[model samples]
Target: MVADNLKRLKDEIAETASRFNRNPDEINLLAVTKLADVDMIRRAYDSGHRDFGENYVQKIIPKMKILPADINWHFIGHIQKNKINKIIGKFALIHSVDSQHIAEAMEFRASNNDIVQDILIEVDSSGEIQKNGIPIDESNELVHFITENCPHLNLLGLMTVAPFTDDRKVIASCFEKVRNLRDGLEIDGLKLPHLSMGMTNDWKIAIE
Candidate 1:
């Protein structure tokens, strides 16, 4: 089942990327293994999907212990400062990095552990009050601070969750804004190369 899903997902991703003249490899497929069991995740691994996203530490740790070390883990949910210690040497990317406090905790943990973790700055592009990310206006300042304070944390990219809407234009505009932000920051030597905005629901539109 997992292998079939992976193959289908890969085909869908390839088609979407092609529509935008993008290399299929340019778009990454992170298997969101939040509620999936170890067997399911390992099945995904067997099918050549190396990247996995987990939301909770409790669910992820046991799976991590069972899975191979080569698997790339991405934390895609709200991360607490108190939870930082447990995840210090575990994850490869923390996607919900919103505040300075969490940033500091990650910095201290990564620095002390001698682990250089890659991170994506989560931006609240849609102004969702319930979301956990820095506002678009303060993104630059937060990025600057991360660069200065966390030498062990590499700011690999930025991520945003677009609100669910029937309008395709709104979705396109959101992704365009993220792309523009990345480009604008690059002019100032901030080379943020990754933009993780799309999900299973509208990933087709996102690739375009």
Candidate 2:
């Protein structure tokens, strides 16, 4: 069942990419593997899903060992400074880089290992106080600051989780905003290529 689901998701993404005149390969799928078992993850890998996202450290490490070296692991959860060492070389991308303190800690840790880590800045697109991210007004400055200060960490792009709204127009508007921000920053010689937005429910709107 997991394999079938993965395959269907891949096909759907491919089709959606085609609709946008994008190459299917350009749309990388990061399977959200939180709470999933090794067998399920293996099934996803076997089905050609190379990127896997995990929200929990403990649940992710075991699967990391079992999966093939080619598989890309992405950390999508809030990271503790003490636990920074454990995930240094493990993730291909870290999508939850929200603060200067965490960014500095990750930078210092990566420098010791001589490994450059790719990361995306997460913003509170929903505008909720409970979420952890740089404010929308301050996001660009934060990105610029990280690029200048954190030599070990590469700022790949911006990522946001929009509020849950059933309206398709609202969802599309949110994703457009992310794209616009990325585009505007790119104009200033900042090469932020990835705009990580959308989820299972509103990915179609995101793609549009």
Candidate 3:
């Protein structure tokens, strides 16, 4: 059943990408395995899914231990300062880095481990008070700080979470805002190559 679901999701992604004249190959399907158990994740891996996103540190650690070494783990949750040590070297990409302090902590830990940690700057594009991301206005400064001082940290791109809503216009606007922010930063000379936005609810809009 999981394999079938995976195939259907990929098919949908391909169909959606085609609608936008996009190469399906360019769209990476990160299996969000935050809720799935280790056995379930292994089954997904067996089905050829390589990238997985987990929401918590404690949960992802054991799975990383038991799973195949080649699986690409993405840390997609709010990162607490105290737990930075546990996740620094383990994840392939940390997708929720929002503050300078967190970036510094990641740099320190990755430097100690002799690894360059790749991360995305999460932006609170929706302006929600509760979201875990840097405000859009302050993102550039954070990016510059990471590039200039944090040698062990690689600022790959920006990420944003849109509000879960049925309003298509609202969702599209949120994705566009983040994409534009990324583009604007590039104009200023930062070479950010990834834009990790969207989710199960509105990924098609993100692709467009």
Candidate 4:
């Protein structure tokens, strides 16, 4: 069942990518394994899936210890400053960097380890009170701060979480806003290459 589900998701992702004239390979299929156990993750790995995202540092650490070293782990959760040491050298990508304080702590940790850390700036495009992301207006300053002060941190791109709504238009608009924000940053000489938007609920609309 896991293998079937993985194949179906990949197939759907490919079909969605085609609709936008995008190469499906360019769209990374990041399996959210936050709720899955070691056995489930191993099953996904055995099925040829490599990139997996986990929401908590504590949960991901144990999985990383047992999982094949080739699997790329992405930290896609809200980062707490106290846990920076736990996540810095472990995950291949950190996707929820929402503030300068977190970024600086990550930089310090990465520098100490002599590794360059790749991360995405999380933006609150939906303007939700519950979300953890830098406001869209303050994102530029955060980008500048990372680029200027954090030598060990590589700002890969922007990430946003759209409000879970039945309205497809709202979802599309949120994704578009993040994409446009990325483009605007590029225009200003910040080379952001990835836009980590969308999730299980509205990924198809994200591809569109």
For lDDT, the strongest prediction is 4
**Per-prediction TM-score to the true structure, in the order listed:** 0.96, 0.93, 0.97, 0.98
Q: Model 3 TM-score?
A: 0.97
| Order of models, best TM-score first | 4, 3, 1, 2
lDDT over C-alpha atoms for residue 188 of model 1 = 93
Candidate 1 lDDT by residue in tens digits, 1-208: 8899889889988987887899998888888998798998988898888999988998899898889889999999888778898777688887878888888989988989998988999988877788668888898988999998889889988998887887888888888887788888899998887888888777887788
Instruction: Give the Cα lDDT of each candidate.
Output: 0.86, 0.84, 0.91, 0.92
lDDT of 3 by residue, 104-178 (tens): 888889999999998999999889898889998898899899989999998889889999899999989988988
Q: Which stretches of candidate 3 lie over 4 Å from their true place?
A: none
lDDT of 1 at 192: 82
Candidate topping TM-score: 4
RMSD after CA superposition, every candidate: 1.2, 1.5, 1.0, 0.9
**Candidate 3 global lDDT:** 0.91
Model 3 collision count: 0
Better candidate number, 3 or 4, judged by TM-score: 4
**Per-residue lDDT tens digits of candidate 4, residues 144-166?**
99999999999999999999899
